[model samples]
Target chain A: MERPAYRARVERILEHSADTRSLFLRTVTGRMPFYSPGMFISVKIPLPEELRIRPYTIATSPEDGEPFELIFNLVPNGRGAAWMFERKVGDLLDFTGPFGAFTLERAPDRETVFIAEGTAVAPIRPMLRRALSQPCSHSVHFIYAAAKPERLLYRAEFESLAVTNSRFRFEPLIVQGKELYESLSDEVARRWVHGDGERRRDFFLCGIGSGVLKLRDLLRGAGYERRAIHYERW
Target chain B: MARIRVIYENGSPERTIEFDPAAAPFQHDGQPGSVLDVLLGHGIHLEHACGGNCACTTCHVIVKQGINSLSEATEQEEDMLDRAPGLTPTSRLGCQAVIEDADADIVIVVPRYTINQVSESR
Candidate 1:
C-alpha cells in the first residue's frame, strides 16, 4: 500500500442519528488514488488535547471525488467516535491509502453475499452501489443484520437496489437488542443457514465485535474455506 | 510518590517506575499530547493509529488492575470506546487513560484485536 498523499478535509458533518454521524471529506485535489468502492480508510483526528486515529468505511462512490465520504456510528461510550462527533465543518483528517481488499471481483463474478450489522452497513453499501451501477454478471445477495429495525441504516437505499435486479436478494435480519453479545451469536446462526454456505458465493461481513466473530464461526462451520473469505472489522 | 508497572505486549518482563504525586493527576485529555508524551518519555513505543487523537482505537487497552485509581472517562474517551472490539468493563482508550500518581501501580492488557485489526486492514 502506497502512502496516501492527499488528506481528506472535512467539508461538512451530518448526524444520521443521535450517536452516528457522517463526515463528508472532499478531496481538495483530483490526484487522490481511485479507491475501490467497498474499501475503508484510516482517519487521524486531533482531539482537544490529543491525536487519535480511527478507521471508517468509505460510504460514497469514488465518482464523488467532489467530496469523499466516511461513515461512523458512535460506540455509546467510545473514544474515537466521541471525539469524531466533535469535528467541525473544516477539519482535515489524515488517512493512509485505501487499505482493505474487499472490493468486487473483476473476473467471472460469482454470487455476492454482503452481511452487515449495526454500522457495518457503511462499507457494504458502497459495494452494493458498485454492483448496481455496472451490473455484474453474477447474482448479488445483500443481507443486513442489526439489533433491531430502528438500528438498521440505508434500508430504503438497499431495497431500491433490489428493484434494479430481481436476481438480487436482500435479507434483513433483526437481532433483538440487549444481551447484545448473545443476541449477535444467535443472529449469525440464523443468517448462516446450511445451503447458504459452500455455494459458489463471495461472502463479505461487517458490524460490531461479536457479530463479526459469530459470522466467522458460522462461515468456518458451513464448509467455506478461510482463504475464500475476505473481510474488514472496525 | 506513586509507583506504576508497565508490561509490554512483546513477551517482556514488567518494569517498575515511580512518579511524583505533586504533578497533575493521570487524566487523558482525549488528545495526542500526554499519554504519548509519557510513553515516549519512558522510552516505550506505543502505537497510535491517528497519531494520538481520538480518530481510531488502535491504542485500546484493558485496565487489568487499578482502573478505579485512574481518572474518570470523559465524553471523548467514551466516544472512542464505541468502535473498539472485544468490549469489556475494563476497557479504556489507552490514549485517554493516564497515570497521575507516581506511586500508583497499574496493569494494562493490550488485546490482540487492536494490533490484529490494523495489521490485517493494512
Candidate 2:
C-alpha cells in the first residue's frame, strides 16, 4: 500500500478544555489521503531512550483544507500523550496509517442513539454531523458523560450542532457528588422507544472500558440485539 | 525460543527463522541485543521499528502460520494494540512477541494497515 508522502507541521493548537488540546496539522505536500471518518492515525515520534508510536483517533471528517486536524487527550502516564501535551506549535511529527474498522454504517433503524465520554467523542463527531445534516427518516440522539463541565471537550461544537439540527438531541452529563454518571441514564433512556415491541436500537458506545459495559447492559436489557450495540472503548 | 517465518508481500517467497527457546523473548521484555540476532547471523533484516521495544507498528507482520507459537500478550502490548487501528484476531506485536515453538513454523503477513497514511485526516 503506497501512502501519500508529505511534510507535517503543527499549524494550530487549540486548548479547547483544561485537559484536551486540538492539534491541527497542515500537510505541506497537499496530497490529502482519503480516510473513513472514525479511522485513526499512528504517529511515530522518535525519542532518545525510546521511540514512540501512539495511535490517536481522527476527530474531523476527511478534511483536506489547510490544516489536517487531530484532537487527543493527554493520558497522565502515557509516554507519547505526555510528550504531545508538551509539544510546541511549530514542531514536526511523522505519522502512518489512517487505519481502523470501528465506524458507523447506516442501518434501516429510524432512531439513532450515541453514547460517549471524554476523548471518546473524537471518533463519533463526524458521524454526529452526518446524522444531523438533514431531515432524515431517523431520529439521532447523543449522550455524553464526562467528569465535569470543566473537562468537557467540545461544549460549543456539540451545543451548536444540537441547536441547528432539530433532529439531534445531546445530553452532556457531568459527574455530580458521588454519582459519576448513569445518574441520568434513566432520563437518557426515556428519550428512546426501547420498550418490548420497539425494534432494536443501534448504540454507538465509546469511552473507557467501564462506561462501555454500562452502555452494553442498558441497551441489552431494552431488547436491543447484542450486535446492534457497537462499541469502540478506549 | 520459538520458530518464526516472515512472508514478504511482492517478494521472492517466504523465509523461515528460529529463535533459542532458552534465550529471552523479544528484547523489549528486557532481553539483550537484537531481534535480528538469528536473522542477521543468517542474513535476514526483519524490519523492526524502534530497534525492538514494544513500540510502533511499522515492523508489523500478520501471523499467517502459527500464532500459538508466540508468547502471550503482555499488558503493555495489549494496551498498545487497543489503539493500533485495523486490529485483527491474528495480530501479534512482532516486537513484543517471541517464538516458543519447536515443531512448527510461524507464518506472518505484513498487513496493509501498517503502511497507509491519510494526507489530511482525523
Candidate 3:
C-alpha cells in the first residue's frame, strides 16, 4: 500500500535557540501516525520553478499526538529552511512520514549513552522521552556538544530531564573552551571506560556524517562492538 | 504507459497500476509521483518513513519481476537497503524505483515487516 501524504497545518512556532526554530504541525485529518523517537518526515516545499522535498527529524514523540514538532537551524541560504520559516500559523503544509530507524533501543542491562550535536538533538530528544517513560535500571547519559553555548539545543530540556529522571544524566559540552576543553568523543570515551567494564554499554551518535563516523570509529577502537554503536548522520 | 503489479503479502489485495513517464510523477494525491506515489494514489499505504528520500529502508519492496525495467538503484539506495530486514537480491526502495519501461510490467512484494526497531513497545 502507498503511504499517503497528509496535509498538516502550522500550529505554532517558537525560537529554540539563536538560529534554530521549532515548528509544531497538526494533521488536518487522521490521527498522527505512530513514530518512534529518531524518526523523520519529509515535507514538500513549493519553490519558484518546482516543488522540493526535504526531510526533518520529528522532535516530539508519537505519544504527544495531534501536533508534531520539528526543529531546524536556519541555513543562510537553505530553501527548505526559508520555506519553513515563512510558514504562518494555520498555513497548510504537505508532508509524509514518521520514518527512519533511529529509535531508542532498550538495553536495560547496559548503560546507554547518547551523543548529539546541533539540530541532531531533534531525534535524540524523543529517545530521551522514551527512555524516561519506562522503568529503566541501567543509567542513560546524554552528551550534547556544540561550538558555543547558545548552539547547544535542548540544554534546558535535557537538564530538566536529568533532574527528574534518576537513571538519566545530561552533559552539555561547549567546544569553545581553551586548554581545559576536551573533545566530545574523548570526554565520552573517558567516562565510558572508567565505568564498570563488566556492565556493557550502548552508544547512539547523531549529527553530521563526518562527526558520527569519527565518533563511531573512536568507540569501536575503544572495544565497543560494532552492534553496540548505532548512529544517524544528517 | 508502463504497467506495475504490486502484491501485498499481508493480504490486503494486489494491484496493477499503469503509469506514464512523460507525465512523470504521475499525479495521484497531488504529490511528486514514484512507485510509492502510484501505490499511495491507489490507496496502498506501504511504509515510507523517510518520505522517499532514500534515507531509510522502510519502503523496501522486492522487485520480483521487471527489475530491469526500473532505473538502477543508486549507491545511496543500495547502502540504505543493507540495513533492511529480510533483504533479497532483487530488493529496491520503492521511492527510488522509478518506472522507465513502458513496454514491460513490474511486480513488487512488500515484506511482512518494515519497521527496523529493536523492539515494538507500542
Candidate 4:
C-alpha cells in the first residue's frame, strides 16, 4: 500500500483573498485517492536545476472528491508559490502523498479545540467537518487567528457552521495595530479548554513554526498535557 | 540495491526481519514506503503520527548499528530530533532513514513511549 505518485491536472483556481488562493487538482486517473484530514501531499514542480517538492495540506474533505483542494499564501520568494502562481487551468502537476499524522484522533465524547493561524486553517477545516459528521457528543471550539481580518481564510464557512451547529463555536482573532500579542493571550484565557469531570479535551494547532511553538508552550503552561496538544507547523 | 536487516526490539515479543533494497520504497498501508513503511509492512506498527512525512518525531528509532550505512540526516531532521523525548546521537526518524549502503545491515530500537496522542490512540 505504498502511496504512489500521481499525475494531476489543475482544474481551477479561486482567489480567496488578496494574497490567498486555492488550487483544485484532479487526478488524471479520474478518481480521488484515499486521504485523511490533516494529511498533506508533496507537489513536485520543475525548477531549472531539479524538481522542487513542496508539501501542502488538503483543504477540502475527503468526500469532496475529484478535484482535491490546497490553499496557500503567496510567499514573496518561495519557489513553490511562484510556480503555483504561474499554473493555468489544465496544467499538469506531479505529486506524491496523502501523508502526515495530523488527522483527527478517534476521541468521541470529549471537547475538541482547534486553533488555526492564517492558511493553517487548511488542515483544521477537514477535521471540523469530520467532527460534525460523526455521532459524537463532543463540543468543538475553533479559534482562527490572522494578522489582519483580510488574512483570515474560511471565515464565512466557519461562521456559518457555528450558526447551524449548536455544538460548534467559531471565533476570529484579528491582530491589528498594537493588540497582536495581548489578543491571543486574552483569547486563550477566556476559552474553557479544560474538560468537565472524567472527560478529556484535545487541542489541535496549526500555523507558522514560531507561532505554533509559542502557542504550544502557552498551552503546556496552562495545565494541558503534551499528549493532548497536536500540531503541524510550516 | 542495498540490504537492510531490521530488529524490532520493543514490540510484543521482539522480532527481526530483512529488507531488500530492490524491493524498497516498499508499499504497504498506503504509505510512502520508508523504514517506517517497511516495518509497518510487516505488521510492526510504529507510532508515526506524521504518516512518515517527517513532520513529527513519533517514529524515531535508534540506529544501534549501521548508522553509517544510512543517509546523512538533513538539517530539518536534526531540528525535529531536538523535539523528540529521548536524546541519542544515533537517533533518527524511521521515515527519513533510508538505507544507502549495500553491504551494511541495520539494527533499530523503538523507543518505549512516544508522546503523540493521536498515534497512541490509533
Candidate 5:
C-alpha cells in the first residue's frame, strides 16, 4: 500500500459502444508511472461512507507515451462503473498502479494467441501490438468477441494490423446470449485442437470470469502446460 | 468473536483485532470474514489486484497459527497460489481464506516480498 496515488484529469472520451468507453487521462500532478503494456491502474472512488478501489487495465502502451487510456463498460448499479461514466473533461480522479503480472515474453519462441471477450480487449490490444512490433518475430493471433458486429471494440485497428502486418491475425466473433462461452471454446478447439503439436503455442486470455476460466480449462485439457497460459478476470 | 493477529513485513508493529465471524464481509473486496476483508476493515491494506477474484496472488498471507480455522483452498486458488512468492504449506490468499470458526484465534504474516507488479495506496 505504499504506492503513491496520483491525480489525473480526463482529457478526452471515445464511445466504443452504447455502454463502453475509452477515457484518456493526463496526470495533473506527479509524473506518470512506468508501466508494462498489460499492467493496470487502480482507481479509488469515494462513496458516502468509504472509498472503493477498482482496477482498470491501461489500453495504451508505455511506448505510445501519455495520456494513457482506460476502457470500461457502464454496468448498471455498479459503483465503479457509475463513477467512471460520470467523468468529464478536466475532472480529476485518483489512481495508483501500473500493476499486473499478465505480460508477454520479451522474445516469444512460439505462436502467441491473444483472446478477448467484451471489453477485455483493453489489455489484449497492447499485448498484440508488443508481440507484433518490429524486432520481435512471432505469430500473434487475436480472437475478439462481442455481442454483435457493432460492439466489436477496436475492430478497425485489429483489422488494419492484420492487413498490414503478416505476423498478426485477427478474428472477430459475434456472440449473443448464452452461447458466448461455448462459441469461444469451440473456436479455440477448431483453430488449435487438431493443429500439429510440433509448434508450441502460448495463450493470453482476458475477459469475464466465466469465459476466461472456460478457456483456461479448455487449454489445460488440451495438454497445454499451466505455465503456457496467462489471464486476468473481473 | 475471533482474535486475529497480523505481523507486518516492513517492521511495523504487529496488530491484533477482534471481530464477530457472524457479522461477516467487513469489507467489499474479499470473501465475508476473510483475512483480506477483516484486515481492510481495520484500516489495514492488503494488495489485491483482481479485487479478490482469486485471479492474482497479491493478497497472499502465511497462517502462522490456527490454519485449521480457515477455509480450504479451492482448485483455482491453488493454481494461482503456485505463482506466489515465498509460498509455504500454510500459505493462503487473504481474500479466499474465510474464517469458519467464530471464536478461532489466528495469526498471519505478510511476507516481505511479493510478485504483484503493482504498488498500491488506500
Candidate 6:
C-alpha cells in the first residue's frame, strides 16, 4: 500500500547547536503510524512552482510515546532545510512514512555497535535506547564523531545513558586534525577489533556519504559479514 | 501483463519477468505498480536507502526502452537523480518511475555502483 500522508503540528523546537535543531512534532489528525528506530518520515514542502519532499530520520524512540522528534542540520541553500527552518510552533505540516528498512534487530542476538557522525546520530540514538532496553548479555557501544565538540549532537543524552546503563559505552571521536577514516579505524580497532572471537557483532553506521562508506569498508575488510553492517547515508 | 527486462551492471545475464500493473503494490517500498515494486516483488534486489521516498539515489536505474510507458519524473525525483552516479538522459529512480502503460514492455539497466552500497537492513 502507498504510505499515507499524515498531518502533524510542530509542538516545539529545541536548538541543539549553532547549526543543529530538533523539532518535536505531534500528530494533528490521524494517528502517526507505528515506527521503529531507523525508519524516517518524508516531509512535504509545497513550493510555488512544485511540491518538494525531503525525508528526515525520526530521532525519538517509539517507547517514548507521542510527539516524536526529528533532528536535522540547517544546510545552506537547502530547500527542505529552509522550509523546516520556517516552521513554527503550532504550524501544521504534511508528511508520509515511518518508512525505510534500516530498523534494528527484532531481538538482541549479538553485541551492537552504533557509529555516527554529526546529525547522523539522530537515528542511532533511538536504536541505542531500544537495544539497551532489551535484556541481553552483550554490551552496546556508541562511537560518535564530529569535527568539533559543538557538533556532537545529543552528547549529554548519550553520556547520561552510558552512565545509567551498565552495558552501554559511549565514546566521542573529535576529528579536528586527523583524517576521519584513520581516526575511525583506530577507534574501531581499539573498541571492537582484536577482541573476543566468540562475540558476534553487528554494526549500524550513519553519516555523510564518504564517512559511512569508509567505516563500512573498514568493517567488511575486518571479516564482518556483509549483512552484519547496516547503514544509511545522505 | 507486460514483459519487463532488467539489465545488470555486474555483467550478469539480463533477465525478463512478466509484470501485471493490476497486481500492484506487490510490496510497500515504493509507488504501487512502480518498476521498483514489480522488480522487488519478483525478488529482484534494488537498493532503496530512503525507502523509495525519492529521498536517496541508491535506486537509480536507466530506462533502456519504453520510457514513454513510465510515469514522468517529478521535480523532486529529478533533484535526487542529479546526484546519482553514472546518470544518463534516461536515468530514473526506479521507485518513482511507475509503470503507467501495463501492456507496453519496459527495460531498465541497474548501474554497477550506487552512491551507497549498503542497502537498508531488514
Better of 4 and 6 by DockQ: 4
TM-score of each: 0.62, 0.71, 0.71, 0.68, 0.92, 0.69
Which structure among the candidates has the greatest DockQ?
A: 5
Error of 6 at B103 (Å): 21
- Compared with the true structure, what per-residue lDDT tens digits does model 1 show for residues B77-121? 564575577768988776666656445667776665653254445
Q: Model 3 chain B: which ten-residue window has the lowest total lDDT?
A: B25-34
Worst 10 residues of 1 chain A by lDDT: A99-108
**Model 3 chain A poorest ten-residue lDDT run:** A177-186
lDDT score of residue A172 within candidate 5 = 94
Candidate 3 per-residue lDDT, tens place, A96-119, comes to 665676677443456788888888
Give the winner by lDDT.
5
Query: Model 2: what TM-score for its first chain?
Result: 0.85
Q: Positional deviation of A128 in candidate 4, in angstroms?
A: 0.4
Evaluate residue B78 in candidate 4 and report its C-alpha lDDT on the 0 to 100 scale. Answer: 70
Which regions of candidate 6 deviate over 4 angstroms? Answer: A105-107, A194-199, B1-122
Candidates' lDDT values, in order?
A: 0.63, 0.63, 0.75, 0.72, 0.83, 0.79
What is the alpha-carbon interface RMSD for each candidate? Answer: 8.1, 6.8, 4.0, 7.2, 3.0, 8.6
In the order shown, the candidates' DockQ scores are 0.12, 0.18, 0.24, 0.12, 0.42, 0.09
Here the TM-score of candidate 5's chain B is: 0.92
Q: Report fnat for all candidates as fractions from 0 to 1.
A: 0.20, 0.17, 0.37, 0.15, 0.24, 0.07
> CA shift at A196, candidate 4, in angstroms?
9.4
What TM-score number comes out for model 4? 0.68
lDDT: the better of candidates 3 and 6: 6
Q: Write the per-residue lDDT of candidate 5 for residues A1-234, one digit (tens) a residue.
A: 365678999999998877889899999989787776788887888888888878888999878888999999988688888889989988999987766667663646678898888788888888887787765577888888878887788788889999998888898988877578789888888778755453268999988867778888888788888888787766
Q: Model 2 chain A: which ten-residue window has the lowest total lDDT?
A: A100-109
DockQ of candidate 4 compared with the true complex: 0.12
